[model samples]
Target: MKRTLVIGDIHGGLKGLQQVLKRAKISEKDKLIFVGDYVDGWSDNASTIDFLIKISEKNNCIFIRGNHDYLLHKYLTKNDTNPMWVNHGGASSIKSYEHISEEKKQRHILFLDHLKNYYIDSENRLFVHAGFTNQNGIGNEFNPDMVYWDRTLWEMVCVMDPSSSKNNELYPKRLKNYSEIFIGHTPTTRIGKSTPQNFANVWNVDTGAAFKGCISVMDIVTKDFWQSDPVWRLYPDEKGRN
Candidate 1:
């Protein structure tokens, strides 16, 4: 089987991402799949995008659109009408592009626009930025709002209680889509925690890398995981927590 490495939200931590990749020992023959949020938050959004673009051109790479990515694309394409965009890390993403030439900015926007919302491999593994919705039946087109903004799915899947299993039945078995769904956007305290119900094979790889944590990478086939130690520690909020 071809080894597939699925990366969580990068959040513009290029050095952290590099360390994760190096520790994971990614090889040229392996497929690299990004769950999105490549740019925004920390810094080096331009370099992050440029590096991913180069890797996509040279190797097998799948890029999915995260909420932040969608917001970034909106600003780049529509000149920023969405206020929610700014509140959700879009400001930093825009600042990342400020030093780039207009031509390059347009190129980046075009690239973001072309990214698919999800990717499914032949092995029945589904990869999406956020969780999918089952409203109006399953296999329906992914709702953009849910894709970019919904936290219900994470709540439904991430709770650590046996009762949470009941929530899994909300989606009809017919709509139980993929054998496994790889996702990002929800920052778990740990990486690759299975959903409350065993019915959905969900892997959440976002380890809060932007908030004094580490970036994570997981091998789909082997279930092996790797992460970097926090390289940049920012002061915590008034709550004194990330």
Candidate 2:
């Protein structure tokens, strides 16, 4: 049987990403859904993109756009080296491209440019980099930028009454539109977790690979997950997104 896997924020930890894939025993038959933040934080920003692009060519993959990814794309294509971005992981990403050929850099740019803001699978499961604010759901989202930048959806679900039924009046209409929602951006580590976290019908897969935590991948249907060693251990010499 084919497995559908949902991956969390990578944050340029190519080692973590590779470890998880090996642990997961990934095959061509498996479908990979990446929740983004593929670049920035660690030193392998360019190398990570190269690996992703190469793997995508041979395996089924859906890549979502993350806020950091947008920043990287802006820096690459428009020269918008925003200071805030630089202070928060963008500096590493910028440095990673310093030695790349212009042609390869352009290919990476195209890859970032084409990342999806959000994706809804055949199972009516929504996969997005962050969260959407549209109470009516992603289809009715007004701000395209908000889809990958909003934290309201995650914040809402995180505090929801887990026992509340869907029929409850307080249940969020946005979540009701989909069977389940998978998101990254806000790391589970914030809540003292280094594993995939589920609250209500939404799952937060970002285990903080950008920081001290590990990278995680989950079999969405089975709820079985695999994680790499802590990213800080993977790159002991660098302070990744700390």
Error of 2 at 79 (Å): 0.8
Best by lDDT: 2
In order of listing, the candidates' clash counts read: 0, 0
Cα lDDT listed for each candidate: 0.71, 0.93
lDDT of 1: 0.71
User: On residues 1-242, what C-alpha lDDT tens digit does candidate 2 reach at each position?
Assistant: 79999999999999999999999999999999999999899999999999999999889999999999999999999999999999999999999999999999999999998999999999899999989877888878887888788998888888888898999998888889999999999999998888999998899999999999999999999999999999889899999889
Model 2 Cα displacement at 14 (Å)?
Answer: 0.3
Question: Which residue ranges in model 2 land beyond 4 Å of their true spot?
Answer: none
**Model 1 C-alpha lDDT per residue in residues 1-242, reported as the tens digit of each score:** 46789998788778878888899887788899898888667666788888888778766999988888877777777787477666555666777788899888887877897787778889888888777666442247465656655555566655545444324665434225667877788777544542211323577777777565678888887788888766355322211123
Q: After superposing candidate 1, which stretches have Cα over 4 Å from the reference?
A: 135-138, 160-175, 190-200, 234-242
Q: How far off is residue 202 in model 2, in Å?
A: 0.4
lDDT of 2 at 231: 88
